[model samples]
Target: MASSLTKDSAAPGTPGSEKTFFGHPRGLATLFMTEMWERFSYYGMKALLPLYLVAPGGLHLNAATATAVYSVYVSLVYLLALPGGWFGDRVWGPRKTVAVAGTVIMLGHLTLALPSSGTFFAGLGLVAIGSGLLKANISTMVGHLYDGPDDPRRDGGFTVFYMGINLGAFAAPLVIGTIGETVDWHLGFALAALGMALGLGQFLIGSRNLAPRSTVVPTPLSAAERATTLRKALIWAGVAAVFYTVVGVSGSYTLNWLLVPLTLAGVVIPVMVLARMKRDKELDGTEQSKLSAYIWFFVAAAVFWMIYDQGGSTLSIFAEASAENSVLGWEFPVSWYQSVNPVLIMALAPVFAWFWLALNKRGNEPSTIVKFSSGLVLVGASFFVFLAPLSIAEGGHKAAAMWLVAIYFVQTVGELTLSPVGLSVTTKMAPAKYASQMMGVWFLAVTAGDATTGLLSIAGVDLNKMGIVALEAALAAVAGVAIYMYRNKVKSLMGDVH
Candidate 1:
């Protein structure tokens, strides 16, 4: 199986063949910086959302409603990746889709800077739509920079790329959170807009560094077929418009209504995708086996993310209400706590990358599934660690800030193990024609977990408490063990992918 997965050559004079940046493709630097700035905008805005919603000068929503809204907003950001990927794969290609989406995202931030409820929700909608377009396709483009399934550098590339993502995430909360929390919320949003604009400019300037394959439209449709596709898309657009208009006019709409359907879609869409792939005549036996194994990875990722994603919602609430706000005589904003994971990720990603590469050199690297299982266990342990401090704190008393920091640190470790590897594996396993679309499917796992995060937050499940924390820890532990027990079977199903 290992022999079957040997690296293949990239064509000469292509981006994939060049190793101009840290021994990886030069294009990686371009994608890295692009993602960094995009994440800066995205996380910066997110850090402000929960606080802004409950602020007197902002939306004035309650905790439950705000968390619910946050969940829905984040879920949609990933959910929209499905169509975004399809559009890139079949229509505009990754480069153009990212450009258009970046513009739309900037507009969304601008709209958010306005002090009107209508504009606020509308801005969230636009951002969600834009993110759906950019997120998966950008990742797909990163995967394209590698030559084949056996590229030893593939995981390392994604790890480095993930570092770029965290670079943005690390700075965003400190800058934007300070402004939003200490100065004006709208100004913070404007800063986010500026970040996106700068990212767009950089991406455009460096567009030439991208792989030629990143801009190729896979399975391009003929003119007549395209016309038919456009007609169907417009019809769906009309239907969506009518539905939204009715809901808006009724004034009875709530985040719960949105959450129900989104959650269902998260579960159902993956099942449908797997079913279709299984039945596809285009996939070979090995491809089918790899896809089957991917489902296990997908489930593990979803479970891990559901717990980890509380960083922005439930964890935010904890920081605001239950965690000590003062650090070394400075009263840090609760939103700043959101930066902890990113900061740790930036510090730790390179170490993790080197660790994996060293192990691979010794032919002793854990299978992808093993790494994923280990991630789940670590994340579950994070909850238990949180419980240790909370269990002793008196009711209505704030816990130490270090407790939350420790939790974020542990969770960051889990993330390093699972997230980038998941991205790399998705690229390795997906059928070539459905590459972008499959990236969207990978994001759907995150969507499911994010939607679940919203549900738990709305239900007032506390991560700091014994009940919920214990439950999550137990579930993650069990899942990890189950996956480990089945590791051999999964590897066999993966054929040469391990």
Candidate 2:
């Protein structure tokens, strides 16, 4: 398959080529499959994590503790991308970093396959590190595949790539979820390891699909810069080791306690990164203004993900404790619900373009920030869809499976509105040297969302689903309205990028 991907004499997207990957590039197929398998690895573990933490034959942690662990684990995965992106550019280059990260993810899944509480946390840590590395670098690599900001195929290409993400996610619960729930959790985790192993092999073979510049150092480190970076890295490593060692020896710190500092880091890091971007001399006034507009988009992305990403946590709990699991005489695992959003993504990816294309023909298409705001509002509305179910459950009736399906449907639409566009917009807005470039800033939005998600999941422990849902929904609505009102200003700030 790798050989076939590169076998075309004219190369993909060339004058004579027909855009071999669904009217795109053949290399897109290789990358598309690579991301697909990687997502299968990711979503496979995700489908199992929440349930395994609390179920029998699992870690058997209490609900609050399990939620804490889930929150921290997911939060740290994106949070670590800040450093992971740095390592990719300044150290190993994006291509090698992705390979290394994929290997770590495989090892992480294998670790989870071991049967012990200790191994569980260890596994999550390793997977988070690898995912952070892979995600930060890989999305930017996708951006590199296109000609530039003005390329018409760029957005569509990313949408295709994004489908690969959901395609893998769609298969996860059906494969890993069914097995994990009906069989051994360890075996399910082992399956995830196998998917990553396959992804690594495919990626290695299809390595040529990557753009030439994508493999080179975009910004090389000078001698003095290298020494300073090394010094900082060593100091941080030593400090982290000693701090964790002291806490470990004392046995006084709980996993929940770690969330405090993590929350702080999530809040601070984005600000610091944005400040670094503003201070960068390479960016012109127009780029800086574009970034200023991006700040609002970032807020929208964070809010949307804070609610949407909870599908694996809060929604999964609903599927377990409240949603009907038996249908037509067949019993299904709660994890089966995990596949809903991804399946919709696969279904909707094609329609998304045509929908916008029709609107563009009418000259009434919404701007990028407007689409982001719409996504935020819609995600919030998805949570609000749970309101009736919560009330119904209070009266002792389980929710119909379709209620969860409805929520997922709405959430998927909202995600499609923003997720793919965000990457392309970030790529267009960012300069080459502003601290991990576009991806770092883009993922910082996710870091902030996931950081707060852990704290928000605490609401689930007390069964305050209605209250939390209402508050979060209302906030998103307000934010969306504000962004819509300010759309013109944001567009102005964006200059010619949009």
Candidate 3:
């Protein structure tokens, strides 16, 4: 296909001759398609995995057992990103790392097509590792498309990128997850492979555009690229040895213990370095000040993520167990409802982007702090939207479908305001040397949130009725208090984005 994206024929600030869709770059569409397909595979499997493991005709495991397995899978997916991000930075570079990650995911899907617990687990491992490598780096690549830390277009670009993610997620559960749950579990896994195949193909064809990696590569004795290449080989070898011994051999028991120290180190080491960097006279004051704000934003991002990340964990299981999806005498599988959040996201992203920009023009825009606060509040409100249906249900009856849709709608708005904008902020606040690592720090928040969700699930709540209600209520209350207490401080920390 001919490239729809072209350089501005006219000078900077001059209106170009060629038109773009939705008033954004055409390359955004290509990336959108690639991401959409990839997410189709991921969310498709994710939506159905819990049900597949516990359903009557499926793995036939108990709810507790299924949930534990689900938690482990989700936790590993995020946790693995630690090494994935580091390897992308120091060794393979983002582009190659992403490509390799895609290949691994494809293999995972293929392995999932087999009918054995061993194959199922093996597939899950591949998907987890692959997701770890691709997730953070691909977002990093989006930032790389912009020229500088302060580029105004960067936020808009990430919004477009986020939409691509939703487009894939929106379709997956509806089309693929449903098929898998109703038809054949293996068929759904095969469909995931096909989705990855499409993404891998699109990326390979578009490789030239995605070149010029910003992730750090170690310089070596010989000034040439070859010496840098050799050093990277050694780093990856060390990483593989670590994963093999810590996670592979020792099992989940050892994995848990090792992750504690590693995660603590990931967060503490970076902030401590920034503190030292501030005292040095060589750095610009604007730059030094931005660094501090970035740390605060990162802290907030981590907290918000704990609430936001439930979609793939407890929320997925919740949708499977409780949400009613019947209309006109037809029944829909519960997992299919997982599509709602992304669907709402696809519809709302442009509106939120323009809404913020419109407010900015009027000089009444929310600061990044204000936006983050708004996100926190909106997400809390979303959980409460389900309280009514949840309370009304009696016996074995499910909650009304409208409740789930309402929850997703509110959550989508929260995501639109906070998620991509947070990415832009991370890129803007950090200096170049720390750019990729700061992104890792932002994701570490997500990892923390996922881990928290698992802990909450294991809290021995009443799985049938009252337990879910308590969980949602607790989440809402905590989020509201956090936002209220930090509002002024966040606004102050945002400095002058206005």
Candidate 4:
């Protein structure tokens, strides 16, 4: 549901004599709003998914099953971006990919607007494919609009574009979430579709300002090569469709079965790649040592996300089941709690940015490993907020919303602590030849952690509320402590990375 892939990207669109948006580029405004609505679709559904699964009028799935489904769906969404990046770089180019991908996403949401279990599965697949296609390329296109890395407008432009994403994220639950909770879930999905439609339309109109590079494939295929690739892809697609149809007809297939392989893939793919990089004859001693250090950071990042990203799963469930959703005698949807994190990020993220900058200026900043450890500790400690609610809110009583809000705020700070630095550090620490792949490696940490989250729920579905929160808190705290205890050793492995 979150991404480190595009977090550190440049911004703006084609610059020239064209009038700019917010003093950047007109193309930026287009992409910014397009991304905004696309995210609205994504986060809106995220807010509603678990509740809809368990609703009497909905899928009627149990809590653990629904959460697992959500987690796997999220994990796949990120994983597919790897291929998406390749497609944009080699085949369709970023512009065409974005336009087509946006349409697919809209259609997926429209499919979800229908009321059927079969449509639900198909719709999720479409959305995941579309999201994968759009995820990395759109950001790539944003970078293309700039005049390269030295473009002064790049950072500011990306900052504005980033706001678009968070704006959609912050507003989604407040708008679509309320409708889903009070009106109907299908109707909510339809609105998500409409959001994508609006974004796609705007993008089509405004993409004229996009740079020529938008359509340039970094690796183009010749006619015969293209034909061969398409043929093989179609063959594979046909085989998959047949397999799915046969499995569905047998009534022996569960979504869980797909998850087992996917969960393994999330961790395994990165491990295999990192191991290859470590053993590559092309690298020297320093690069190899950095990889060793990176592996430690990778594990830490996975643990951090495993704990932080639970805001939408078990935490959301806790809010729905045990926390108050009313104020001044006016009841609100529990899904609104999902918005708290983004809004806090919007408000406090700048403060964190300035604070870290000031520390750097004063030469008082903590080392990267220490910052990561701090993030782990803080995020883990946020889990303890649930302790009070679990203690006093016995039986059917709901706890105050402020406790959850506090947890989200602290977690946001923890997020700011590690995530912003994690991306840059990974890039800086990787061997020169492995620069790009290191970005993918950074993302794999997120995917692995997210998949692990679902796997744990599937394995520990019977865990009590108290036990669950306690375990999460303890796991993160212990990881943080362990990482801190060996910080000097990790730093040594990092060599000159700092």
Candidate 5:
């Protein structure tokens, strides 16, 4: 199945065409740089968020509360992608949706640069909502760059694009983390706003390189339909406004207040999407089967992210509190640890791309399920590796920085197997009319994982590293086994797809 997907993906294009940016469509370079800068802003803020929340001059929240807030923020960032995806598919298209979202995100960073707690929370909300608009659609646009499933460069293109993500992620912590940790948190956020400004500028300039198809609305509604949709949107917005007003007026606008609703949405949205898709008379049996397979893949991805995303929450705290910070002579900022995964990704992505290409040539690549299961196991093992140093340490001794680095290295390998492949597969499996919507549905897995991470944070799991590691390892093992056992059945459902 994997070989078949690869074969179709690698089909040759017109021989006489000129290669523009590393033998890819010229638009790829534009998307790559735009995504890089967006991530620079996103991750720059992300690297500092939890630390800032608990810092002496900032919120001064406890680690558990801080993690809870971080989790909810990150979860919403992905969850809101549902509406963003819908808007792109049905209304504005990816180009306009992304441009608008970028502007919102820049404002979000600027809001964070303010010192008031009210503005801080408001900033988080804006960033989360804006991220939903951009992340999935940008990825959707990346997939569209290829002519079809037959574009052999599809997976490779995504890998290169994934490198752009890592480039921004790699630089953010080093730049923002350093200033935020050493200088001032608000200054770090200001820098994040600056990053987004650069990205928005680049996007406006380079977006024209994209194929005209990228701007095609998949489902254009009639005037009456548009009116009804607008009415419903306004009603929802009014309700949300009232709720927020009440919370603000009551002085109850805390992370705990936000957590419950976001968690519920994480569970509810996927169910609603699945139900809607199942009932759609337009979809045939093959599409239904593929959608069913995608649900399981979604579950697998959620599990992987729940474990992986701890890097920003529990892991960051661990880096600050329990891990040795000194390297050679100078002490490093804890947020710098966030860069380790991206650094590894930048270094190793091309190798994984080549490895997959080689496997495809030999017709020996494992199925997507196998890769996902392996990724789960690798990430699971990372927790155990993280647990080891903590277990060995005695009398409140701090673990060496190398332990966290080792954990991130292992997790990055798992990410390489799962993340880019997941993106490619989602594009492959989605029904034509529901392309952007399905992409949004894919992000719901991250939403669920992130929400779960937040719940765990509120439960104070960070205080017990060994217990958390053990729990994660066990859960990952079970999920991996289940996926492995059902791999063949899922592949069969995928029909002609890998």
Candidate 6:
């Protein structure tokens, strides 16, 4: 009787269908648990990294140097997504790639749990590679859970999924970063390893419910897919060889190594894809126009990213230097401030989701382009919340913690407005053949942004003073002008697609 009930529950579309629970899948819960823990580990390690470098017995590197290195690390993690996406499209299906990547990430966390310089670098390498694979693919899997393109449940599902991501991110730093500061670094790293293990376990268990990838070649790959994949592999291999020479000769490969090729690809791939589309004669005029619009938005997003991604580099250093913290008669560790944005995200995502839906129903919501532009402006504005306190902190005094918290609260709302919507926009706008590659191109902007952040760190900006305010104001003004000038065109391009 129990076996019969289990089989019924697992079956596709009965009253107890495996595909849904309150307008979502029971499987989503499992993936939620999986992603939550994965984020916990990622954020836990991140929280301690800058602190680890500058602590008394730590690397003893200067602030500028360490932030640059940290930016390089973060940038590499995103830039590698090109190959990771290609690997999913060609060698392994997205699901299998996710599993393999999760295991690799787990190993990376464990590697950092040891106390040796060699282990640190090695672990960083592994984590970067693993993040490349897992980050792109797991999100891809969330879309895979639905059977059709216009599934109503899809948007809600991703919101729930993003909540899980923030849940882990919000909790990990507080728990693991605190432990590292109070107890030991190894224990914090060990916590990361454990978190990843939980994510991997949940992912494995839920694998049975995931829908198969649309691009998975059941028989054998067509000549085109195979040829494209082979070219991609060769391109990746060339990138690796160049990095090998860079590290061998200079003892350090700058973050720019990852950006160079990706930047080129971002330019070239769209042209190549359009050429292919023209040759096939398969795309209609509307489809072609939509693709063109996507390219434009990608360009705008690249500009926005130049400011948005400062969080891990310039903003991080600012927090380390100036943010005030005191709790329970102990000053909170500066790194703990990183938790602020994630915590706000966890609490506010649902509200924003509902708000968008409600506005949509009333025909009163902003268009996608407007929303993106607003996000850019808001991100810029969020930086200024600290301007007063920062200006006053010049003599090594701490700035008020409320300033940072205020910034995060506003910035997280901006994040909700932009991020998931951007993901959905890309998937909707891209042609089926170029979908995965275009997603990779989207990330190239992030790589460029991180590279720019690194360069800014090298410039020695006085982030605790008017510098941050000037930078923020500049971003807001540029974003506002761009959006205002392009308003009609941007709205036309969206063409009721949102």
Local lDDT at 329 for model 5: 62
Q: Note the Cα lDDT for every prediction shown.
A: 0.82, 0.80, 0.68, 0.83, 0.83, 0.71
What is the per-residue lDDT of model 1 for residues 1-498, given as tens digits with 9 covering 90 to 100? 111222333434547444355667777777888888899999999999988987888888777677777877887888888888878878898899999999999999999999788789889988888888998789888888777757777878887788788889989999999998999999999999999998888789877878888888886778999999889989989997898789979997876666666666666776787788889999888788888898899888888988888778767876777778787877889899988987787778779978999999999999888898999999988888878656646465778888889888999999998887898899899987676477678888888787776677567654446787789878887888889999999989988887
Model 2 Cα lDDT, one tens digit per residue, 1-498: 534543443344532244366666555676788789999999999999989988877977766666656767787887788778888778788888889999999999999999777777788889999998898777767777777868787878787888789889989888998898899999999999999998888888866766776788766789999999889989999998899889989998777556667666776787787887788788878778888888888988888877887778877876777878767768788998898887887788789989999999999888888888888889889878978777778789988888888888999999989887897788788765553466677877887887777665544444336887788888887888898999889899988876
Lowest lDDT sum, 10 consecutive residues, model 3, at 8-17
User: What tens-digit string does per-residue lDDT give for candidate 3 at 1-498?
Assistant: 426545433223312224332444444444556677788889888887888887776777656556555665766776678678776766777777888999999999989878776678789889989989888777667766554657666677777787778878878888878779888988888899999999988877765545254434432224565577668989988986786677666655533353344344434544555566567676577666676666666656655666666555555566666666776668887776788787777677668868878988999887666677677667767666656656756555777777776777787888777887787777667665565566666666666555554554445433335556556546555654565577676555545542
Q: Which stretches of candidate 3 lie over 4 Å from their true place?
A: 1-30, 142-160, 208-300, 431-433, 459-468, 471-475, 492-498
* Clash number by candidate, in order: 0, 0, 0, 0, 2, 0
Taking all chains together, each candidate's TM-score versus the true structure is 0.87, 0.90, 0.78, 0.92, 0.88, 0.82
**Model 4 alpha-carbon drift over 4 Å, by segment:** 1-16, 222-251, 393-396
lDDT of 4 by residue, 171-245 (tens): 999999999989999999999999999889888987787878898898888899889989999998898789879
In model 1, which runs have C-alpha deviations exceeding 4 angstroms? 1-30, 140-161, 208-216, 247-251, 281-285, 360-364, 392-394, 431-436, 457-465
RMSD of each: 5.6, 3.2, 5.3, 4.3, 5.4, 4.6
TM-score-superior candidate, 2 or 4? 4
Instruction: Give candidate 5 regions above 4 Å deviation.
Output: 1-19, 23-26, 140-157, 212-218, 244-254, 279-282, 360-363, 392-394, 431-436, 459-463, 495-498
Off by over 4 Å in 6: 1-23, 150-152, 209-288, 327-330, 458-465, 495-498
By TM-score, the best candidate is 4
What's the lDDT for residue 7 in model 2? 41
Q: Please give the TM-score that candidate 2 achieves against the real structure.
A: 0.90
Candidate 5 global Cα RMSD: 5.4
lDDT at position 62, candidate 5: 90
* Per-residue lDDT over 163-206 for candidate 6, one digit per residue giving the tens place of the 0 to 100 score: 78888988888898899767888788889989899889888876
**Candidate 4: residue pairs that collide:** none
Model 3: what TM-score?
0.78
| lDDT (C-alpha) at residue 211 in model 1 | 86
Worst 10-residue stretch by lDDT in candidate 2?
A: 7-16
